[model samples]
Target: MGRFRPGAETDRFGIRIAASGNGVHVTLCRPGRRPCIWLHLATAGTVADKATVDDRPEIAALARRAPRLEARALECVRNDRVLFHDLDAALEPGQVLQVEGPNGCGKTSLLRILCGLSLPGAGEVYWGDAPLPEVRAEYYEALAYVGHRHGVKGELTPIENLRFHRALAGGTPDRVPGDALAHLGLEGFEDVPCRTLSEGQRRRVALARLLMTRRPLWILDEPLTALDRSGVAVVEGLIRDHARSGGMVMITTHQAIRLEGCVLGRLRLGG
Candidate 1:
């Protein structure tokens, strides 16, 4: 929920507020320091109407305590063939689940099921101690999904795409759009349209969103697909830091990647 009023500016604690038709954007700042997240206020009517991830019990518990993602008896069927049959897994804070298998092994399907992009044929997914549906919207706030498609707009520059994702997620909690692009090794290529960038560059643009938000759960599918050695190293390093700092990352990679200081878990989907 929002703590500031729109248009009528509130500087009680150096909070900057601006109003739009139905939503509000706020920048919380400290003396001589960069502003924090540009928060999204769901509505302009009342503070109670402003939706925040913490306004819900499920998300609040997740943030306040150790977060875990659990999948029980997850099953995926295709044309009467069982891809995943009664599959089960659990992911905790500071952990990485690397879904590994050969092609056509339903690795993507399992990850999709975990990310709520697809439903399981049999069991359920739990966030913290509650079912996913109990905290669906808030769960999304804490989740960052990067699929095989790269999720980039062909006509948009890397910076534009990153900024677009930032807006979608409410704000850039860490690096700004430009800095995130630069950090992902897309410095001079920031202004180039994705259509012109190499395969690896486009993947980097998609990954730049990771720096834009501080979501705890990362669902990445084949993040190493278009990366060169250096790019792969960068991605590995990001994954390591995320887990080390108590964030959870679920990745699908066929390449050999060693994550330092993480409790690694593996799942074979079609086995």
Candidate 2:
């Protein structure tokens, strides 16, 4: 395997990519760490050679600098009718964007398009100046998505579910499963199947995954769905800390949220 540095500058998380005989390798280097840690960032098929990676300004800058997400003239459509059109927005590091509108105004559609889950009928979504399709693997590596569904297996205990989530990431998490559960107020329910938990508790479990994920961009859809006052505060605190740490967030919520130390922006659909 040969190591390649996109540039002398470091990525937001101090990551480096190396080309191996079979695929690309991503490593995280932390200050004072003797050896870099391997990250299981998916590389779609063969990666570009060192020169190729460096040649693309978008890819190079994404690997070596702060990143931005942009949508230009996005149009969301359903059936044969258009739901919304001409939407333009940009989300920068250390900023939170809230998407709001009446029911069926395409708030969910817009979020889906921005997160690459669905395609826009018109216009383009870019991650650091490159179209999302061209840099999918890299963009996904930096993204964490939480949608309307709880996304947890009913049969799996909270701890088991969390561990499975970490396994899928293919990287060591910053926090352990138990610690994450505790932080999300799931301490006593850690070993029980999520099916037995209350709606709010289950929602907490879903949101707890954010704590273990080290991704820089969070795309959340109705993150406050079933949470109560305290739970809502927890979600707000998480967003605040993430923004303070230079992470970007795009969220959809019916309830207003306050992030004291972070810049918050809003996009209203069908307005």
Candidate 3:
């Protein structure tokens, strides 16, 4: 590990990756409290060098950064119809990959494959320098996925629903559930059961998970669905903040999302 200089150009979270002779090394440095942690990515198999699983988001964050995500030659076929062919894409820290096309272009299908929810007809997905199969568990741990379904239980309140999500993940919560709800404009409505909330509110409730959890890679499908003007802006702000914090997001939307300073790479399917 190199020396940590104050006011240094460290990453927002002080992440630095350097390649070594046999493997790659990752270092996540904080200002002065914890020493810089040096972890190596093995050329094969599970990472022998892993931080102990703890209930702290920082520790988990450190563990997830070394491996970047990549998808290559991805092809999908459904019932003899070619959804997409030989799709290739990559997303690194502080970047966004926007998958856009007309309806029935397989935008959602590609996202599902990227997040490991479904398998591709043919292609390879890499996590860091390793094939995804070798690091499946680790990859999923570092990923956050939001699809068309709100995934909110109608019987649960916004707070309860978010709490349930956090519990299922079993990791440290980034923010209090109530705080996440409030941040998404659900302050007075937190206690109300989700069934009573409108479609937009339910979507907001689901979006709140992005605030309450920390994950390096976000794969979203129709993220702005059912959102109003302000809600769309809120979602955009979240994407910007996440990228600025050294996280990567892959999104699919119908309308163009223009972020003044953020560079968006587009993947348009079905020419």
Candidate 2 structure lDDT: 0.79
Q: Clashes in candidate 2: how many?
A: 0
Better of 1 and 3 by lDDT: 1
Which stretch of 10 consecutive residues in model 1 shows the poorest summed lDDT?
56-65
lDDT, candidate 3, 23-134, per-residue tens: 4456765433464747865444322233222323443355445567899899988788999988888887667889878899899989888877788999988888888888
Cα deviation at 235, candidate 3, in Å, is 0.4
| lDDT for position 244 in model 1 | 66
TM-score of 1: 0.76
Candidate 3 local distance difference test against the native: 0.76
Model 1, range 153-214, lDDT digits (tens) per residue? 99999988988898888733567888888778888998888999999899998998998987
Clashing pairs in 3: none
Winner by TM-score between candidate 3 and candidate 1 = 3
Q: Go through the candidates in order and give each one's C-alpha lDDT.
A: 0.77, 0.79, 0.76
Tell me how candidate 1 scores on lDDT: 0.77
Candidate 1 lDDT at 33 equals 64
Q: Write the per-residue lDDT of candidate 2 for residues 195-226, one digit (tens) a residue.
A: 99988898899899998868889999998988
